[model samples]
Target chain A: MFRIIKKSLKIGVVTGQYQKGEPAAVPVVPEVKKKAGLFKRSFAIREVDTGSCNACEMEMNALMNPVYDAEQFGIHIAASPRHADALIVTGPVTVNMERALKDAHKQTPDPKLVIALGDCAIHCGMFKGCYAVTGPVERHIPVDVRIPGCPPRPADILEALSELRNGRP
Target chain B: MPEARLCDDVLKVAFPAIRQNAPVCAKSSHFVVPKDLLPAITHYLHTQPNFRGRLTLLWACDHRPVRDTYGLYYLFTLEGSHHWVMLSTELIGNDRLFPSITPHIHAAHWYEREIRDMFGLIPQGHPDLRRLVRHEHWPKGMHPLRKDFPWDRVLGRQQGEHHFRHIEGEGVFIVPVGPIHAGIIESGHFRFSVAGEPIMQLELRHFWKHRGVEKLFEQQTLIDALPLAERVSGDTTVGHGLAYCQAVETLLHLEVPRRATYLRTLFLELERLSNHLGDIGAMCNDTAYALAHAHCGRMKERIMQLNDRLTGSRFLRGAIRVGGVTRDIDNGRLTEIVEELNRIQLDFSEVGAIIFANASLTDRLETTGILHERTAWDHAVMGVVGRASGMDCDLRRDRPFAAYDALPVNVALYRYGDVRARLRVRGDEIHESIRLIRELRGKIPDGPIANEPSRSPDPGDWTLSAVEGWRGEILYMVMAGEGGRIHRCKVRDPSFVNWPAIQWAVLGNIIPDFPLINKSFNLSYAGNDL
Candidate 1:
């Protein structure tokens, strides 16, 4: 127990603050902020992996790490869709996961924003023409934001979430 | 004596039915065996004291438009030999049936079921011929891997219900979990049959993320399919990418530069180090040791950032190409990597000491989930899981690839076969990986990063490549088609073999300990589903 406390103290605070007007930062718009009424102060996201290669999920998990510490920005990954303000969906939406994705989206309350989290979710990425895929997330449900990368880095995901909180779409 | 020749002599005497010998690629020898003789040959090779062969891969290919046969290939790696033996059998003339080897060899169970789902082939005398890859909604009579089925064809869904094995007892109840999980992980379902607290039985329903990755490879050119291979499992980009590239190089007889070989080894070690650290942390988090999780996560982040600095991608994607690596590491960057790894090594050792010293964490991990050696062997489990259960198999040491042939690797083995055993194996392997990277950085030769293929591979020419990924052994069997297109590319992630072992591991353990056991294995759903 003493060792644990010592290690914790030695590590200190490693979290970094997001800089203003960073390259990953989205431009804040007034109209977007007006629409994000309940999500203005804090954002609770529920990440739904439709059929990702798992890199996007790794980055998402990294968001909770000590370095990223997404909780510091008032962002938390909710345990369920009902408690979530937005749904961050990844992957190309395979046929088997189509119903589950739609169900999760419907479970989230009204005024909920859906963010397509990766290149696969945005445009199906490299898995564009595969038989089992049902295309990008937009094909099934409405998408409010799209973060593009084969898998966007954790900082990129954090920036996107900050934009969502600040009412920047 | 050459290992292949020794294997050939033994096989020739044991089974005279072995037909013409096909061309050998790398350390692998190919032979065409009669369909009837395949089961006996495999059974003999597996049980023989001198030649204890492990079934590495079993995949079927639809060979229409050129030949009127559906080919089934069985690849085996022998004990104490670096040689690989692949036996090919043909199901010809309107008969889609092949004698099942699952009854005799338990490891072939999932492979036989997968062959049935992908192709319309029927394995005669197989006990359970249920759908392995295809979900219930997939239309009946639709085998997506057939030559008739187009890569982008759309199909209508049909109503079908998956029957879960029910155990009827006084206090038994079934707990069915997700195709969509609560956590930010890949999607797969698990059904746990429980009585009070202890789990009676566990059935895993995976393949919810099957994206027809192999069929997609058919539509891509040889060079264009590297990204698909990289994405087979996101965490195992280097493993899958290196396997695919090595297979292609062997088929085309391309010579990789010595520097690129060492670089591939370096990048692979880095990938292994990052994943092992993350998994060690995840296991701790599952055990409610958040402090270890935090420090390990920080160390993993540093490794990932180093990967980004050396290569463009964080997961070491795009680092491997057909003949060699995509980029070269300069001397200064190499020095930086050595220094960073040294710092991480020190930090990891400190964290490791603290975590192991904590009675609460070690008690939770000690005997929570135990997989016996017999069960692991029956399932042909590979990588850390296999090593934990006393299966003496490490593809890097057993069958050397890249710079592994020159550089020695100390395989980490443990006999406990519990969660603690798996944890210890990963921890040991992390240190070993760091050592390998430091040694590789010093000895890396100076040359071009990649080499052009000498010529195009002829149609139907194929080869198998195996790499020891962070998870385990990742195998890729690439067959070339007309004009340098991929005819059939069969990918076997270690998860495909190791996933079933989890069910056996969680037998007597409590339901709440399932996640800790599952996290220890850390099998890839996408890789398995694909």
Candidate 2:
């Protein structure tokens, strides 16, 4: 648990990206002490594969393993919406899978963060503005973080979620 | 004397329905056969000794001249020969009816429904033409491939397919799985009619998220269209790009320099390798065979790292341009790429030997999802999947394209027609791909990475192009009107044809083995859904 948090927080500190949306300009919000992010690292994540080829799924599976060590950080990905605090949605959401994806997002609790994992999720990366997909993640729900890799490496996804916990700069 | 001669005579006997002498100027040997004689033509073609007339491909493209009109294309191939035949028909009137060849080519089942859903064409005698790759509530008559179907319709799509046609008996119960499924997959409804756990009937519903790729092609410029093609199926990104780019090149008659061909060849192989890696792992994962899957995942990761080294993108998008590829490898990168691929292939050999040696994996796979040799011929499925089912066909070897023409593709053959066969064939092909990639690494020609700077194509010209995609032969037919604004574009993925065989394969097997059977083929749901 300490490992994932530290790694994720370190990525945040390094990249200096604290939130999902890439902000061009902002009023200096005070560096509020995030007690919410500090301890008890149990994250309820909801995964929505937006018409992915399923490589993202395999990468997600890696995070569940010992090497990527996501479980150690209390970043628990739940199957149910009621329990989810973070929604992990992959991109290029096909025309066919769009609705259920939206419903799942709406079902998640408030103060929830959306992690747009994989290049397809970030800007519809490879699929890039295709017909079936009219979304990067923002088109459908409030995407709080963008983990960009063709499939973001497991480390990247873990890092994005951790940074979201601390809030964006 | 033989069935080949007899089939030729039958082709003559059938007369106009099977056009024996159409204008061959289209660079295709086969005729535009009618849907009615598909069975007889294919049946006779298969029976001839050494005839090797394999069913090349069965696909649908909404070759629309107007907003609501569309046409279907079914392409055929000779078993070992390079020649091919095509059958086409316009989907007319409100009903949009066409004779289903499922009875003849069993492989036509899923494809027919896909045509039904995507183009709103009805296949007569289709037995069960409920939405194969569409959600029920996708709004009837709004086929995604049709020209007029709006793109914005995907946002608020509903579960319109819940009330499917079913058989209600004293104890028959209908269990409808989600447009939203349990795990990480796109939305599709699978309604199973069962007395107990034994499924009597199964219907796979999809199209909850239909973005109308074919229809929308009319609206984009060629450069923009390449990205849309790449998104056809994430697993087959490079393949789709290759197909589309190849078509554009053909239209422009621009020769891709040797280096570009070599680079494109390398990326194509890499794309195949990565997807195969993911497929094998996912198949095993689905079948409760995690040990082998994990190792494959590791091997896949190595392949991805190689992709990152060669091109900046893991998926290798933007790696391909209209005439040639955008990315080029330096000699050092080439050496490293070959060395890394060789190492990965070696590790894969260890993994392959282990998986093949394991009796449990084979037991579950062999004869588990049997798509009989006869049925394989009937549907004219393409790529590794068809070849495994006793169909000796590969576009690379039979109809040479890219740097593949230089490389003698060792087309892997498997007659088992089951999940194990598909797995075994993929394993064999991976080795072949590795060998090809290594040999072509240093031989790349010296030239510009890409050329012909971008330009628009002329209107009123229609071109038909197909490439040996990773999954199989992908057919793309493009027609543009009003000075290349785009009249219609029809794209076909092999998964559209292969999915129905799953229903047949799962029938006799106990319900528990459905996952293994389904995973063996591992046809892309989204690829077909589009």
Candidate 3:
């Protein structure tokens, strides 16, 4: 127990301050509105992987790590869509997961936003003509934001979320 | 090539039938056998005393336009031998029925089911013929891999039912998990039958991320297919990309430069180090040890950042091209890698000591989720899971590729097949990978990084490339078509073989401990589904 405490103390505060009005690290599709703050301060997100290669999920998980420390901005990954204020969907929306993605979107209560998290989610990217894929995430449900990268880095993901939280482009 | 002669001698002595008639097509290590002799030959090789052959790959290809037949190939790696023997047979003339080898070889269960789903080929007298890849929503009698099925065509959904094995008892009940999970991970479903708190049976329903990857490979040029291979499983970008490139190189008869070979080895080890660190942290997180998780996560991030600095991608994508590598590391970057690895090794040892000292964490890992050696061998588990269960197989040491033939590799083995055993195997491998990278930095040669192919491969040319990815052996079998197009590309990720082992590992463990066991194996959903 002492060793644990000592290690924690030695690590100190590694979290970085959330910078606002900075240049976007990753390009976001259709630009964020300057004054429509759907999630004011605290943001609860439920990540849904419709069909990804899982690189996007890896970057998303990095947000919770000590360096990015997304929880410091009152952003947490909710266990269920019902408890979530936004749904972060990844992948190209394979046929097998189309129903589940819709169900999760429906399950999330009113005034919720859907953010597509990767190039695959935005336009099906490399998996464009795949027969098993239904299309990009927007083909099934409405998407409010799109984070574009093969997989956007964690810093890019945190920046987009902060932009959404602060209602700043 | 000498190993092929050895395989020929061994097979002729054991089975006189092959000696009586010449093989239909005898290449370096590939043989064409009569369709009826496939099951017998595979069974003999798998169980023979002096030649304990492990079934490495089983895949079927649609050869409709070229030949009115479906081709089935069985790949096996003999114990203590550097060569792999491939036996293929043809199901000709509207006869889609082939003999089932799964009755004798348990590892062929999933492969045969996948063949049936993709080609509509019936495995004669197989026990279970249930759907493996195609879910209930897929329409009946529609096989996507056949030449007649268009690549971009979408079929309407149909009503279908998947039958789960039902268990009935007084206190027994079923718990159905998700195609959509809570955490930021890939999609897969798990069904656990629990009696009180302990699990009696666990059934996994995967393939929720299948994107017709193999079908998409057809009609694509060899260069264009490399990106698809890199995306087969995002985390294993380097492994799958190297295997695909190696297969293409072998088909084109191109020799990679010595510097590129060493660089490939260096990148593969870095990929391995990053994944092992992440998995170690995830295993600890599952056990509620946040301190270890944080430290390991930080170490993993550093390695990933280093990968981005050296090669332009965090996952090492586009680093490997056909016949060679795309980027070269300078001396200064090599020194940086050595220094960074030294710092990581020191930090890792300290974290390892802390993890060992924590009794509560160690208690949860010890003796929990034990997979018997017999079960492991029967299922033909690969990689860390197989090593943890005492299956002495590491493709890097046994069948060397890249720069592994010159550099020595120490395979980590643990007799006990528990969560702790898996953890220890990953830890040892992390150290080994760091050592390999440091050695590579010292001895890396100066030369061109890539070799360009002069001409296109012949229409019927085909070859196999196997790389021991961080997870396990990733196998790619590539066949060339007219105008240098890829006729068929069969990808077998290590997760395809290791996923089944998880069900056996979770038996008798409590339902809550399932996450710990699953994390230790860390199988890929997209890789397996594809």
Best by TM-score: 1
Query: Ranking by lDDT, best first?
Result: 1, 3, 2
Local accuracy of candidate 1 as per-residue lDDT tens digits, A1-169: 7877887788788776322222343453555545565676577889998889999999998889898888877788898999998899999999899999999999999878888888999999988878899899999998877888888888777766666565332
- Please name the candidate that would achieve the greatest DockQ relative to the true structure: 1
Docking class of 1: medium
State the C-alpha RMSD over the true interface residues for candidate 2, after superposing those residues.
7.3
Better of 2 and 3 by TM-score: 3
Rank by TM-score (best first) = 1, 3, 2
Q: True interface contacts reproduced by each model, as a fraction?
A: 0.79, 0.31, 0.71
State residue A63's C-alpha deviation in candidate 2, in Å. Answer: 4.2
TM-score of only chain B in every candidate structure:
0.98, 0.84, 0.97
Query: What is the per-residue lDDT of model 2 for residues A45-162, given as tens digits with 9 covering 90 to 100?
Result: 7677667765677568656543454666677667677677767787577665666778887887775667677777767764455555667778777665566766666656665555
List, in order, the clash count of every candidate structure: 0, 28, 0
Model 2 docking grade: acceptable
Docking class of 3: medium
* Candidate 3 residue B291 C-alpha distance from true site, Å: 0.8
Q: Give DockQ for candidates 1 onward, in order.
A: 0.73, 0.24, 0.66
What's each prediction's TM-score?
Answer: 0.97, 0.81, 0.96
Give lDDT tens digits, candidate 3, residues B1-530: 57668777888776665523332222336667888887889998889876677888999888868888899988887776645677888888889899999999999999999999999999997899889899998999878889899999887899989998878989899999998887777899999999899899999998889899999899598877999999999999999999999888877878999999999999999999999999999999999998888888888888888887788688888899998999888889899899999999988987898998989999999999998898998888889999999988898997788999888899999989999999999999999999998888888989999999887888867778889999999999898888889889999999999898888899999988998999999999999998
